[model samples]
Target: MNEVYFPYFDPDFDKLPERINGPTCRVCIDNESMDDCTVVKVDSVNKQGLLLEVVQVLTDLNLIISKSYISSDAVWFMDVFHVKDEHGNKLTDQKVINYIKQAIGTTRETHNSAKAKTYANMVFSPEPNNNNEHTVIEMSGTDRPGLFSELSAALADLHCNVVEAHAWSHNDRLACIAYISDQSTHTPIEDPNRLASIEDHLTTVLRATITPTPTTNQPNQQEAKTADFLGGEGAVTNVERRLHQLMHSVRDFEGPPSRTASLPTTPSDSESDEEAGMKTTVKIESCDEKGYSIVNINCKDRPRLMFDTVCTLTDMQYVIFHASINSDGGYAFQEYFIRHLDGCAMSTECEKERVIKCLEAAIERRVCEGVRLELCADNRVGLLSDITRVLRENGLTVVRADVETQGEKAINAFYVRDMSGNKVDMEFIESMKKEMGPIALQVKNDTIRPSSPERSRFSLSHMLKASGSLITLLLSSNPCKYS
Candidate 1:
């Protein structure tokens, strides 16, 4: 018996496997064909944003798309992705396989259109009448020092326990989504008055800018006071995807680079982009003959290059009629033939410039800023609030953060910088490690970026905090880089 037809993964897609399917999208998982990875093929009728959904599902599952062949020509869209687990291993885990099957495979539900059958890639229908476990808070505001700190403090003062949060800042704009619950009841704060209070409190904090230390709330026009709340069932939401959507909604990329966004010395995406003396370059040109606008991007190769590009295009109401994506010599080359939803190509310099800026913003938003500090401690009430307080004390500003709980463990990560948007000192990093515990922290030197750095597990001497124990930390730098 030939070992299952699964293929080996390529660093980036080289060639798509040959496959044929009917009009409805049918996903086939082949394990015996390639040597190193799982070959996932989806054949179906083409739609404008289907690829974005499919990519989201795969990436959200934490699977890496090492290679792919995507085509959406005529009425058919076909894609073949060579995928691997985070460890670059073929996915042999049954649980992971089942998730893939349930998410975007032939086992998925399919419905018929008038002309052809198509599958509902993912509907995300909200649950009906379930008691929400947490209340969700979403905001897109100005990027400033101690912003996350002040916000976390406000939540703590209000007796709100933050269960999970994901935030990102680019070009002086901040977009965040957090899931919080009442500290006592540990349930969603569904009261209308309480929600309004949170809105007002957060709005006040957003307007306050810091000079050395925040002594008072000062009027800041650059800040955005956009805050809204809903049921916490959104806790299961996609963090990274939602961050991208929220950032776009704020039009964060439309303005000239602010001091927060223009700091080149900080250990951020911009620094890495300029590393090796190369930068991500985006160009847009009109293809008058084809009635399309052609977008070309050349950047250092990393995972999710396609996702970032496609996500931006989809959100901007641009339709990708055809695209060619590939990696060569440690670089990613992407070309998209796109048009507006109105079926017209970009006709003005303004439109082209806007697309270019937005696409560039999309690429940089995911890049790590300052340093990344990962915490693996026991989950408890006010864990996040305490952590942010310590960072603020050390004059650290968080540009990006991802907080989560896995069972009893609080798996948290913060990408932080100094108040003036500079890299953190090594002295402070050591101080944090010492404060956390003996061998409580692990720092990896990141030379080239991965999709995102994985949390370093302190397995040998797991000095994790126990329940109800308060933890404090001061963080600086993206300490974990792919070597």
Candidate 2:
């Protein structure tokens, strides 16, 4: 039997004492048979977000993946990617190969330890020439780990197919230009609605990359109140305004709480054990010589866990250099090498402690709060808006939402909390279920009625009335017709 050893950064291990065999990552280049591209083969233990990480590394190295094959059996993953450098030439550099090997071999516990500063401001414009060519997207922002990955992931999520992409970083600022088209039509996205949705989602991802997470050692009532305010408002306009305010509210807090005060107390040993089992732990340490920080996280795995963690780090303004990710059984273990975008280590001991607490709180809040409602319905325009309206009317605050279309069906998931920035109690949950039950049935039975022409006119009138100035102007333009 082969003994498998997990490589961890043990501060106490002073010297190399013994050799232990374990599961190892393998990366090799094959150039003997391939002519147009370089073939890279990778074998490793499979984990969440592994493929995305690998693609990110390749993208950072300015390589293009022309063709790829991926296979995994729940435990192990083997992949082969046919790639080429920017000049469309095979990779022949031994040093680059070594770097790739090191990048893939090192676990997240010890990767991404270098400091590089980057800043980005994004501008999105649509080009519609009626010829179905391409749409160009431009972004400039602070360069950090997984930035490219985030952009690519957003594009993928929005069903945009990338045709060409170029990115460059200098003096800590990064700029990217991409040419993309609609995945379904293979044409430039001409629909205003689809383009707006794409822009909205991409903007969210890009903004997260540049925003810094607020460091709060102790929960400030003001900040919590602000979050609650934003969380409570379900109206689109109010939510948007409060969210803008919440983004600027994070600031460094004064000092750490007293040790006893910082730690949560348990009533009994058995209950304490149960609570510990459900808790999430996030650790941050300095890799001074490597000029980066190391973040180790352990928690129960859930949907979009990787995206949530990366988004949090990016929002906190820390750059990830390298990472190893794994999820097994029901738990997830992630290691990240990170540094502040300013290329400085965490300023104070309290800041480090604050990072840990903030991340733990984020994960806990995500896991414990919000009822998840999954809805499957026939794909229809305006369906999402209707569903959201229902939720808003029911006093449910949508903390998170994901909507995807599969063939003729739409699968939507929403994480909702009550108005008070807390989990939905049983009563609320039951109420929500009762209300959503009919909506779901209507969707399944295709009984949803379309808006009548009179209803449409009435809706337009309502919209105009809500905008007092617009209504006044319209009435003035045609006073006799209105009267």
The digit string of per-residue lDDT tens for model 2 on 271-351 reads 346446855788888888877678889887643355446555655677655666666565777777767867677767887
lDDT of each residue in 9-123, candidate 1, tens digit only? 9754432332334336577788888898898888767766677767766765556676677777677777888887656788787765655655564312331101110111112
Estimate the TM-score of every prediction. Answer: 0.76, 0.36
Q: How accurate is candidate 2 locally (lDDT)?
A: 0.49
**Which 10-residue window in model 1 sums to the lowest lDDT?**
111-120
Q: Pick the candidate with the highest lDDT.
A: 1
Best by TM-score: 1
Cα RMSD (angstroms) for every candidate in the order listed: 12.1, 20.6
Q: After superposition, how far is residue 13 of candidate 2 from its true place, in Å?
A: 45
Model 1, C-alpha of 377: deviation from truth (Å): 2.4
Output candidate 2 Cα RMSD.
Answer: 20.6
Off by over 4 Å in 1: 1-23, 106-131, 210-237, 255-257, 260-262, 265-274, 446-483
Error of 1 at 148 (Å): 0.5
